[model samples]
Target: MAKGLNRSKLAGCAALAFATLFAGAASADGTVNIYSYRQPDIIKPVLDAFTAETGVKTEVLFLDKGLEDRILAEGQNSPADVILTVDISRLTNAKAKGVTQALDDATVNANLPAEYRDPEGHWFGVTKRARVLYASKDRVKETAITYAELADPKWKGKICMRSGQHDYNLGLFSAAIAHWGPEKTEEWMKGLKANLARKPDGGDRPQAKAIFAGECDLALGNTYYVGLMRTNEKEPEEKEWGNAINVVFPTFENGGTHVNISGAALAKNAPNRDNAVKLIQFLSSHKAQQVYAAQTYEYPVEPGLEPSDVVKAFGTLNADTLSLDEIAKNRKAASEMVDRVGLDDGPSS
Candidate 1:
């Protein structure tokens, strides 16, 4: 019943228990193993609730990078039963790397929208987060904006963002390539690079800090970070950063807001397959979805569930209907475009 465990402690516990936890064969031992890219704090509550209700024990191995490579290297002996990660790129990458297996469950299919889950059943999105514009409240007044508009000359020298090569930006860039052709998307990348307030330097929260400090007038960030920042008791300044800007939902010209997901997949060599399936199914249920909304401030994947009140304060999310599979397909090209433009080199370059 531990709550709010940090990543380091979680990792330590996982390491200690790794050997004994999976010594038995893949049987119904009333336990499930998870390899997760999500931070320990964000997912701990939901996992705890699952165990409380289902009486099935859970063990987690949390890693920031190389989750797929680790699982791949382990092959059939990998102890992982489920993989939890964020963004379409990572999910699709896991599937491509042969680390994930298809999940063909009727309940899971019914719980999530077709666009949010893999068309072939390789992965399932558990929560949705929009890639949004964080505009300086005092300096910018526009209430509505478009993704194409981020490259407009008007925003030059006033935009802050992370590296163009970051997965979050890549997700949006891939969506841009989907909405606009590759040719048009390349030109847009150049425009956005030219608009950089500084070299893409930090995570999404730092972009908000830049806006708050008057270093930039706008920035690109995911919606959940706003809630996380605004409610952060551990860091009072993040609350200020959250308050300094307004969340503007940006859309493709012919589409709705670009959205990404925090999703889960079945490990290819899952030791506890049935329990793993049950865990994923429970995560897709209304109760688990509610924990996601309350604890993480993310939009639940289950239809009809509203996001937390803090997230609701931002605005309704009219998520674009474009299939994530389509967006993921363009990631390689989008990444190439980032390098071609030298987007990480800053605007003055």
Candidate 2:
């Protein structure tokens, strides 16, 4: 409409703008709202891809905590169609809170492993992560390690870890309980606590940082964090922190490595119910599985798929066949054992 515009050019521009607005409007009915506890950077791309593939717009409400509480509080008036989060305990907790509805979809069932999804179908796991070992590149020599070996006197005063109360640690402890029973896991925790390099403090990355500082020679950390730290650009020093150690996917004497899921569930009262199920199905699709795992640095839950190239460098993981459902059942005992063994109290000294 200004000096340079011919009427035809001006009309064309207006038409283009209107078409763009109309395109967005056309997809309004396909919008799937998500209540997610997972960090935005990790899940947004997948959501974007979902929109691109299906014309389904995704609106996310990112929450650091209380996702279940908020959804429950909103009740039937809630717009939350899906809940995206990590950890089996949290998923089980959401189910216990009555915020999620059971989904019965053939595509989801075909894609997710039985061990990774709820038996009642309240959630479907899309990726796999492990609480694996982190050992100093300068000191630890053994390539193969066992979780049981963490308690051996040979490694005394040589290990670093986060608080035993941390969900990451709890996941492992619950898996241990599932594998070894309460009495034995409690004993194992005590001996492992006796081997601490320092008081249980800091998150997983700090454990590797401590190793780099020579405070300890070994640590317990999630596998994905190693990839995140190693590739971190904003915190370049974390790459060095990552380089200081190697991840060891420790296993039980007769079992495979322990692993958990980053998964999503259907909300009980989805405003956009069909679109919500479509979103969940798209998430578990092979393409989404590849993107989600590669971006998040986690292994894909859909079998025959591998984690990103960076995660593969740590070594192949033979995930334990024990159902996460089984591990979840043992969580209460695992938590009690952490307290009973005074794991957070550091060693007996």
Candidate 3:
């Protein structure tokens, strides 16, 4: 398994590598600079493999800061050959801002499903994540529950989740708006807000921890968190956290729970354009995707790549079939609704 990492170094290595190779034009000897939000540790193995296979040095610029803003500031002079990050909304925002350029890669098109990638060739998804529900096994039955049910008076004062302002929560709410419309989505948000056991505070992991501490009967967390806990070699508490819950996929009848991705795009003015394409292709290949899946606990975006064993044990999920674009497009609305409904008070962004 890949070691955990600080987010910034990941960006630096990819971007730095590109800068090193940017001096020439053959693309083979050139480096590929990458601007990424994927923490460095998660992608180190994949990048290392790319370097070993192609002998192309890579540089990365890790930015926890705004990706779109940095790219925009660089304009046509940016050293970035690729932009990698999570969240569909952020990817769409980058495209809208013109920091990303479309690419024609057969490997990307063949491996990733159409919905997971941009309609145009602008970006491609490499992995998937389901925003499933985690409920206390002893306190709650492991039966079916829809996202809308959190608003029911039955769950009032019994729900825990991250702040609504987060990209993940916003994306999930955006999906809600896409499927159920603004009125229904707002209503659902209001109900869910009313039920918050302890204001929406903490990231997915902490939310799960809160459930273990008896802070809430249920919490909203990613599917990977379960796998991380289940497979944790370092933290004994993660195993306990895993054993304490029942993972549930909400609303499979209409559409599955909201899903998102950690995807990539070509930089608008890539110096090592061909190599950038090759790097993306390599990342999307089965071997790299498998490594990514094992490390991050995310589902491979490639159609046929079976999930890592840890993920499979979580059980099959019914994912929302909505195009990620829809979720990204509605992000602003979700953000506003979250603030209006006061879910933003729970966790700090």
Candidate 4:
């Protein structure tokens, strides 16, 4: 069930300031339109809650197609007042393209860390996810390994991963580039590619499944996928999938793993700019943030909200502190390197 929002719990002086700017709805009847890339099943609960509490009947266009491309094509004619999706790289790209506006809100600015939100304020992350390693407990002795170790000779032909072109992979590789200069990171990628157990070919869940089938010893994946597998009520197979591997946070002496996010932005010419701001702020509020973190098995962007018990049971992690914008900015270079080394071909299923 979708949770309800209570304005009484709104935090700090930011709330008082936001109260003045609180525009409930663009239309007289209280409605807003959203264009979302997040799957309907995953995000609908939260949207339902938002609508129920505020009377803001959210009309959504759920597209599996790229949100940026769609918004770009829509141009000024886009009916979208709000944009939602995962991955900092994609949000940063949209910001670069001028598809979203720089939202000026006192509460949003004060509550969100400067690094987490765009410098220009084009977007803010609603929730966070960590990049983690899913290694077979029976095969690997060390419960922990550094990101650089995945390139070691011993790991050669022992690693499983998704397509290098995928945003998550590119984001991790981009972080590697940021940590070490391009040349070393490129060498690392080539070596990592050489070490592939099979051609890198599956989404995170499938890669975890590969480990269960004895196809690989370790697979790169996100923290949330493990949460979903463990908690998904509709699928008994996912419970079996969750049991096959152990989770590891690959800290590169930097002391944490890479983390990404699902974020939101206001459309460039949002007809209901005030209402859009309210909707986004609502998502960032503690109530929505908690629901997002618990439901998605992602880390909440807010400081005090811990992940749900399912995620807590998997264990804890310190996320790599590099600002998401830097990772997004370097994604192009990461993609180029992935192509240069032929990792984009991925493992064959």
Top TM-score: which candidate number? 1
lDDT of 3 at 92: 83
- Cα deviation of 1 in candidate 1 (Å)? 49
Q: Is candidate 1 or candidate 4 better by lDDT?
A: 1
lDDT, ranked from best to worst: 1, 2, 3, 4
Tens digit of per-residue lDDT, candidate 4, span 151-223: 8888877899999999999989888888887999998887788788988786999988888888888889999
Q: Residues 1-349, candidate 3: write the lDDT tens digits.
A: 1334645566556655544544343244568888899888888888888889888778777888787876665556577888988888778888999998988777788877788888888888888899888899889985788888888999877889988888888888998888889998898888888888877777898877888899899888888888888878899898888889988888733867778998999989887888899899988889888988788999887766798788888888666778997678888899899888777664222
TM-score of 1: 0.92
Query: Which model, 1 or 4, shows the larger TM-score?
Result: 1
Show where candidate 2 strays beyond 4 Å.
Answer: 1-28
Model 4 residue runs over 4 Å out of place are 1-28, 345-349
Where does model 3 exceed 4 Å of error?
1-28, 345-349
lDDT of 2 by residue, 1-349 (tens): 4655687577566545533433433246878888899988889889889999999888777889888877665656667788999999999999999999999999999988899989999988999998899999989998899999999999999999999998888989998988888888888888899999888999999999999999999999999999999999999999999998988889997758888899999999887889999999998899999999999999999888877899899899999888988888888888888887889998764
Mind giving the per-residue lDDT tens digits that candidate 1 earns over 209-296?
Answer: 9999999999999999999899999999999999999999998886599999999999998988999999999989899998986787
Query: Which is superior by lDDT, 1 or 2?
Result: 1
For model 1, the local distance difference test gives 0.90
Predicted structure 3: lDDT = 0.82
Clashing pairs in 2: none
Q: Candidate 2, overall lDDT?
A: 0.87
The better candidate by lDDT, 2 or 4, is 2
**RMSD of each candidate relative to the true structure:** 6.5, 10.4, 7.0, 10.5
